[model samples]
Target: MKKYLLLLLIGSSFLTACAQDQFQRTSKGTMYKNFTNNTGDRIKVGDIVTINAIQKTDKDSILYSSYKGAPIKVQVQAEGDMMDVLPLLTLKDSAMIKVPTDSLFKDPHAQRPAFFPKGSSLIILLHVEKIQSLQEAMAEREADAAKKQADEVTLVDKYVADHKLTVITTASGLKYKVVQAGIKPKPIAGDSVYVNYVGHTLEGKIFDTSYEQVAKSAGLQQIGREYEPLKFVLGQQGIIPGWQEGILLLNEGSKATLIIPSKLAYGDKAAGPDIPPYSTLVFDIELVKVVRSKAAAPAAATKKPAAKRTTKKKTTTKKTTVATKKQQ
Candidate 1:
């Protein structure tokens, strides 16, 4: 009985090896193996194909998978690349394609990406979800976008109503209300401003705050992170568009609640794990201080070419703080 079991295991391993060796190569040298043989129409050039894709390295480490999000929609082309294999697939078909890294980075002058080392093959597992005309795909996408925009507006409205808040809506769709009005002399572009703010989603879930106590209360405290007033130049592109626009309405010592739409916030892209795509952000902000800009001074008779100023945008939503110093 033991001898028979060993023979069965060996036979299964051999069959698996033979199956893996059945991959066929395309004219461009892309190797692919189809798991399904559907009799439906094959994908063609100019056809918009929706597919669920899983990208991995030859070591079987997953790089990305559409299962976690929406499937991708792409129009097929005559390009001799890995996408060339799409033409051989039909709707509802499943397949695997392997592309060499050397072919992907064929430019000898360019340095290859560190993740994709030389002689490594990028593997792709694909499932064709749908095939449609370009017109149909565009119409569908537009409808989806319209629905999402309406949904976001409904969510923001409900949150405001539930909190019993009155907001002043702006022409650009920003809704804000001055809780404590400040004196005149509001900050303008090119001015340095300091602020303490608490940012949350429409659901009232706090994602970030400049106050250390707030972070502790929300269980968001990070070790070695100093929670203090955030300092940045007003009109700098480092912050979101909503924050930039809403801050302009407040003067030093003013406190306001800004309810920003997703379009003015992160839009369709998710910011980290806490802020999801199409999220409507609510910020309680206090304008601590504002320093006037030197550029706003009256131009001198011999104006040296105004030096171009460039600021690097912060990639993350978390605010950075500077060490507190005695104000001169």
Candidate 2:
């Protein structure tokens, strides 16, 4: 009877050790599943699909997922970007796949632990909810884009209507021109425009101006403090929207005085001590010449996309900021 009791104790010990060993190994398996692939589309190597998936890592972490009530659209072509299930695309929708650790995305951008210097493995559990074709995908994208544009236009129109500020043209149909009777010199929509201008606060403190453009043009100086009339592809966010909108209404050699309200101009932001917050700005603008495109402007020329309303700012501000090194 003592020997029998000893045998029972040993058996219990062995069983407990095996249970612990099973618990330590982090493998992929599903806790729950409720998805179906009804579309029977023959998935090719380049097919993109909307999948609702969840991923877990060896650190006993559930790292990534697309199972947030909405199906995530994923391109199979971008499979190499992230891994875990790329090497094996065996299971389709409604199937819970246990992914091994060797198939995770190898990233050059991840931090040290995420990208182990010694390298690590990841396990994944996936659920694909739906699939779509390339054309169908493109149509969905276009529909979303159209909806966004419509929404933006509606909001902008409502704001303009409430503020009574939708009149964007002068009597001569020029938006940016010298403020004078019957002399609406303005820039046109499709014309390449050049301009000299000055910016100042409503209190009339000068901040920036193209006044030195004349001295530089006259060859009396190697460089000037002000920028010359520059060229850009109009309507391309190459310049401030105010300048673009204003310039689009002016013809060649037209001039204008643009009085920009705080909101339309740089609102609630200190451009410098020169421009205070909530300042209604003003500019004496001129449209120097309207031509075809000046040239393909470099990335530096139109680097920053504009962030303000353009009553028309002629964007011909192309004065080279970099100076050539002169021999000492």
Q: Give the best candidate by lDDT.
A: 1
User: Highest TM-score among the candidates is held by which one?
Assistant: 1
TM-score versus the correct structure, for each prediction: 0.73, 0.37
After best superposition, candidate 1 residue 145: deviation in angstroms? 0.9
What C-alpha lDDT, on a 0 to 100 scale, does residue 1 get in candidate 2? 47
Q: What is the C-alpha RMSD of each candidate to the true structure, in Å?
A: 18.1, 23.1
Where in model 1 is the C-alpha error above 4 Å? 1-21, 55-64, 99-123, 295-328
Name the weakest run of 10 consecutive residues (lDDT summed) in model 2: 25-34
TM for candidate 2 is 0.37
Q: What range of 10 consecutive residues in model 1 has the weakest lDDT sum?
A: 3-12
lDDT of each: 0.83, 0.51
197-289 in candidate 2: lDDT tens per residue?
777654556677666754444443444244577666577765655676666655566666665544455655657767655455567777776
Clashing pairs in 1: none
